[model samples]
Target: MSSDFQNVVPDTEHKGLVGLLPAVARPFAVLARFDRPIGWWLLFWPCAWGIALAGGAIDRWDLLLWLLLGAIAMRSAGCVYNDIVDRDLDRQVERTRSRPLASGAVSLKAAWIWLAILCLIGLIVWLQINGVAKLVALGSLALVAAYPFMKRITWWPQAWLGLVFSWGALVGWLAIVPEFHWAMALLYLGSIFWVIGYDTIYALQDREDDALVGIRSSALRLGDNVHFGVLNFYLMALSSWAAAFWMLRPHWLAIVTLAPISLHLLWQVTTLKSADGDDALAKFRSNRFAGLLMFLACLVLGQAG
Candidate 1:
């Protein structure tokens, strides 16, 4: 939850269970991003997209639970590792200065330990998945480990994030189907572009800080043309989703039913004010709803079939 971005200073105002908890409990929460659940939601949506779109029936309640838990654990673990690696850079940025690692509330050693704990939880969840899905999930570790360094090396770090964040889409589909399908592959690609679009919007919030810190981001890459770039990415996202849908269900009505989600993405692009960091962040966060809308459309199409 980048909401901490708004309050650079820790809110020492209300000190209760969170503040009074043992020293051990405090850093773990920060490591897990208990203060910010949105990251988990963003991570969870792609899994939902893969599962619901496969039309393989959602009777596997156990698998759904595993995916849900895995999303939370892995997202938290990713954030902890990212913060640990970026602590120096984070200290230079106002929005990130107060982060546990950056602010020295948690030591680097402690952060790594917490990261291990979260990853252990993730591994436990991964073991609950099928062999194919488990292998697919394990394969994402390299991407996740290298993501923090991508901003330093590439102008399009969001594209790298697209790969990291949307890996669950593949795992989700594999958990159900256990075999490759062109339709699911297209849907995974669509989710990647969706992550790139929204994460670009998120990066817009840090453009100034990132520039000063010598960090690269799609927002900096696109600059004044970020809005147009976002439009293009979101448009491509919709097109890929539409292609995925039509490939699975060739009916004209399926494409028609996708209209609402497509219109929503259009609204996101048309009304987006990239110059306003708050507006851009709000729009970025709104993708949770966009994801849900798309999932509902998938549900309808899957059920209708």
Candidate 2:
């Protein structure tokens, strides 16, 4: 369908409301993904994991709210920045051509203004955390700022994004407990691989266009064996989480509680179809549920311990 039809059709009828938002905002709202909440959820999960793992007698409802806001704001800002940098490449892709910045609906300058506003919101949220968490959050800015350039320079841009997206694990953990814990660090590292595995699947959606435009991605790097590569990454993610769990809880039940999450990742790998881009995207989006399951596992174990 043309952008005209896409915009006129109410997003209430669409499966992906986010794409609709960019289409309707006369394209400006795309800067904030008011249309897409999945990115925020993906961004929010690590923070949730950190918060849950840091469980004590502490109530952090206020901090959680701030993190949620920050997730939405920063995720939107990151998307806007990415669109601006990749506008040319985006226009070449079927799925992304209609994006605000790529489609000429929103200018680069306008998008930058929107990005700045979102960053301010993120900064406010950062201030709400402890000094250590604040520093950790600040450290992520460089990663966020440089992410748009990664695809141009490396075939593993998704790996870089894993680092950027999972930084919240550290920030959220340090917020509740100022001390460093190797177990938490391992968990965060595991989450990073999970992001890389899923995001690589997402990147497959544009692999054709990406290659045509000289954009590098793990999907293209892995080539026909992309499925195997993704499987290996997921296995690594599961192993990392297992190590973290053993370190933190060191109980048979804690390990058993994580079975569901590992099985879910296994299900995704065994059933996934890399030849079909839509299939890859659907599988990738399903990680939101995967993250939730893992978070629940962490919450249950943390409370029990």
RMSD values for the candidates in order, in angstroms, are 3.2, 3.0
lDDT of 1 at 218: 95
lDDT of 1 by residue, 1-305 (tens): 23443243342222343456665576567656765667888898888777777653357656767788989999989999999889899899887888778877788888888888988998898887789988888889999999999999999999999998988889888888889989888888988999999999888888899999899999999988987998899888889988988988898888887788788888888898888887887888788898888878777776665
Reference-based TM-score of each model:
0.92, 0.91
lDDT of 2 by residue, 1-305 (tens): 35463553132123245454433453666545666677998999899888877773147767777888999999989988888888888777767777777767778888888888888998888788889989888899899889999988999999999999999888888988888999789888998899999998888778888888788999999998887988899888888878888888887887887888888888888888887876887888789899899888878766766
Off by over 4 Å in 1: 1-24
Q: How close is candidate 1 to the true structure, as a TM-score?
A: 0.92
In model 2, which residue pairs have backbone atoms overlapping below 3 Å? 18-35, 18-36
Q: lDDT: which candidate is best?
A: 1
lDDT of each: 0.82, 0.81
